[model samples]
Target: MAAKSATKSVEQGRNLRPFYANHTPEQLKEALRRMWLVRRFEEMAEESYIRGLTHGTMHLSIGQEASAVGICLELTDKDYITSTHRGHGHCIGKGAEVKYMFAEFFGKEEGYCRGRGGSMHIADPATGNLGANGIVGGGLPLATGAALAIKKRGSKDVAVCFFGDGANNEGAFHESLNIAAVWKLPVIYVCENNQYGMSVSTERSTAVKDVATRAAAYNMPGVIVDGNSIADVNEAMTAAMERARNGEGPTLIECKTYRTRGHSRSDRNRYRSKEEIESWKGKDPIPAFEDELMALGILTQADVEGVRAGVEKDIQDGFDFATKGTNPEPSSLLRGVYTTGDAA
Candidate 1:
């Protein structure tokens, strides 16, 4: 009787473990650090834009850090990802250095695109980041193509596509998902539904209550997760990635999140109420994750402070690097415009 009781207790404990228990303590700590980094980086970027230190507009993912970090935590360096306009968090989560990103934003010659592509077009091939697209639904087809290439090459790598909810209504979204499902291609489509596309709320634009329901038309699994919870996002992503890697075609995951900032720097934010913004602020991913880590004994208050301090230093250094870097010259404008080498 005692043996059976002990067995039941162990089973209960196993069932009670958090969704993120599969990850090591080190990985959890690193995730927390990256979340903080994403939050701080966007804050600094907004400051720089306000001070006229950077040109062009940028879409800041100030409140949607967990979705980015959680999804990328399940990916490897060999895996591919296509990003959207609001993709700074995705890039940082995929192992991009802040200094180079700053360089790109500042239009310095040492940037990822040699100062050609600004905030909306940052890409790092070394990290398997194809590029961030300025157009809505632009990355959907690209991710599908990349997944097709991986399938043909017989590689196990999968492609993850990050797009906003606005893209869901686009024709490309349907086409990409249909083809991906038909071919059994290894692609994961993640929709960061921040409730609004520009000034239009999802309620006003979307026909359905939840975007994930559309996945049924393509005959794929559709999932919904709280984008503010890193563990929840990670759990969903882990399952989706596993299915993709196992040659089970695509999965559509809609992360129901919110963006604290306006659509862009120029946005007046007249469409939403201040109360709504404050309510989402109370659900901020960073503080919630920090509390979770502390409860699990993976981190303490001092450790959290240390992480914040280190991230601050990194952001400052990146800003200094960008400010001190050289700008691009006009003479090299047409250098990479046309292909010069043989196709063969």
Candidate 2:
């Protein structure tokens, strides 16, 4: 039987090469490794939350690894990205340290926010992650304002704002898009349409089936791609980033995927059925990619196991770092809050 990777794009016939044909073996390996890291990270986070290791309610992006990796891999570290509440994958994909992420989860002083912000407020400026927002559509204005600043400074840097399908309905989304469009700001609005928004399915709440359609109102390109297909998402992102960097304006990419976990710790998932969840589970991007790699002779069984072991070591190291790190001291809690004349 022919390998699936031997297949060509729908537009092209068998004459064209496979999707991974253009990518080096090393690149494919890293892609699979990165996706594995995200899956393991989310699973570990959920376990930590249940074990009372992480504070506050936790939102796990368990099934959405491909979407995050695909888009963020297209950008440079100098470019900025604003993230949503379920932003661990975004944060990690954008180059945030897993150790720091674990620190944040454990409320350690070494965390991105010194443990003050917790899960939703994770941000690392060094890596160009503006921050993750706890509020719905909260990061939209922040990302837009950052794009405005980049434009004002005449920098080629771009800003990517990651939001869910639910955030598209928010007022900030419309206002920010309008302003960004008027000025031709360098920003990419990525809507992670994972079927449901905290138990409220998009079919019932959204006006249009495709959230990309909303981009037309702002006079920009609106593209939709399979969120499960990393290559497809990357293709769309490459186009959007080109538009943003050329000062043409923003592009909204609608990535259709599913969130494997509940909305939060309190979620019972009474809204959805087991059959539907299992259907998505069967399409898990990580395993699918793995099988593709093996089928294409790009990865051996030993190579795959080595990657998994390496990822586990990294996760364990992060756990150890968080466990050994000092907790936030109450005395120094307010030190960074108020800016002093000499501090800046």
Candidate 3:
């Protein structure tokens, strides 16, 4: 068992260079900027919610930024992705404009979905975002359908489904996997296993130590990576997406991450111990990746502070934009409810 574990470590070390070795210093800087944007955006959003500026329950992807950015860095604007309630990072990583996101959060007219979708339901067809679903495991079947649609159209566009460990227990997961493997659809199942399904711990719930092992039941490649390590996630996604784009069916990628915040604002997180939370905080993805960049000479302390200042300014601008924008007119509320025009 010791020898097997040592070999696995050596293989992981070799493949973890996909992001570090391939990208230019400039590219790394931009990637880091996006990660920072996600982190700051969530922080500000939480502040806004506390101040009662944004209504509705919002789930923050506070600690899982690396998984979102790494997988999305491999995607193009034409590729499709579905998200869960904790979906801000995924949307941001897929090139969503923070201005409109703020508008939606504020329920203003300028928002994505025209203030109807808010954070969880925001969808942008222009960017190939099918939309974020509020239901657990909802995106699984939808993503599979999208992959099938792309295959039928003979398009190279692939679909990615970003789900949580909670959804793994749902029937949709197994059903979707069976169909995707049988049809060889171009969809990637990304499980952001953050250890807890709301208040329930994984140890008391999950059947296996690694969710990736479940992929075997469907005859697809299963991969597990450190969700805190940006490079490792990118490397695994590179291989998985490569197989998908090449018409080799789907791959199940389990990113073993954690949620630093409560499952939602109402959650006190009484279910978890303080020691566990602090240990995960020590492994925070943002600072972890920043350290990696510093070691490679791609970033300095000054650069880090500068990036923070820039992101702060940008986030402030988004908040200002949302606060100043007009609320959705009551008369137009029913405008998009149904289509009255011809179908074809």
TM-score of each: 0.94, 0.91, 0.93
lDDT per residue (tens digit) for residues 1-344 in model 3: 00012222212333446577666565666668889999989999999999988888999888899999988877787889999999999888888878888998999888887898988898877888888899999999999999999999998878999999999999999999999999999999999999999999888898998899999999999999999888888888878877988999999999999999999989998999999989999999999888888876678988888888888898999889988988877877677767874231
The residue pairs that clash in candidate 2, if any, are: none
Best by lDDT: 1
Q: Which stretches of candidate 3 lie over 4 Å from their true place?
A: 1-16, 341-344
Candidate maximizing TM-score: 1
Q: How many residue pairs clash in each candidate?
A: 0, 0, 0
Model 1: per-residue Cα lDDT over 1-344, one tens digit each:
00012222212333435444566656777788899988998999999999999878999998899999999887777889999999999998988888889999999987887788888999998878998999999999999999999999999888999999999999999999999999999999999999999999999999998999999999999999999999888888878888898999999999999999999988998999999999999999999999988876667899999999999999999989988989877877786777784221
Candidate number that wins on TM-score, 1 or 2: 1
Candidate 2 residue-wise lDDT, 209-323, digit = tens: 8999999999999999989888788778878877998999999999999987889988999999999999999888888878877876778999999999999999999988988
Q: What is the lDDT ranking, best to worst?
A: 1, 3, 2
Q: Lowest summed lDDT over 10 consecutive residues: which window, candidate 2?
A: 1-10
Model 2 CA lDDT for position 14: 28
Give the winner by lDDT: 1 or 3. Answer: 1
Which scores better on lDDT, 1 or 2?
A: 1
Error in Å for residue 241 of model 3: 1.1
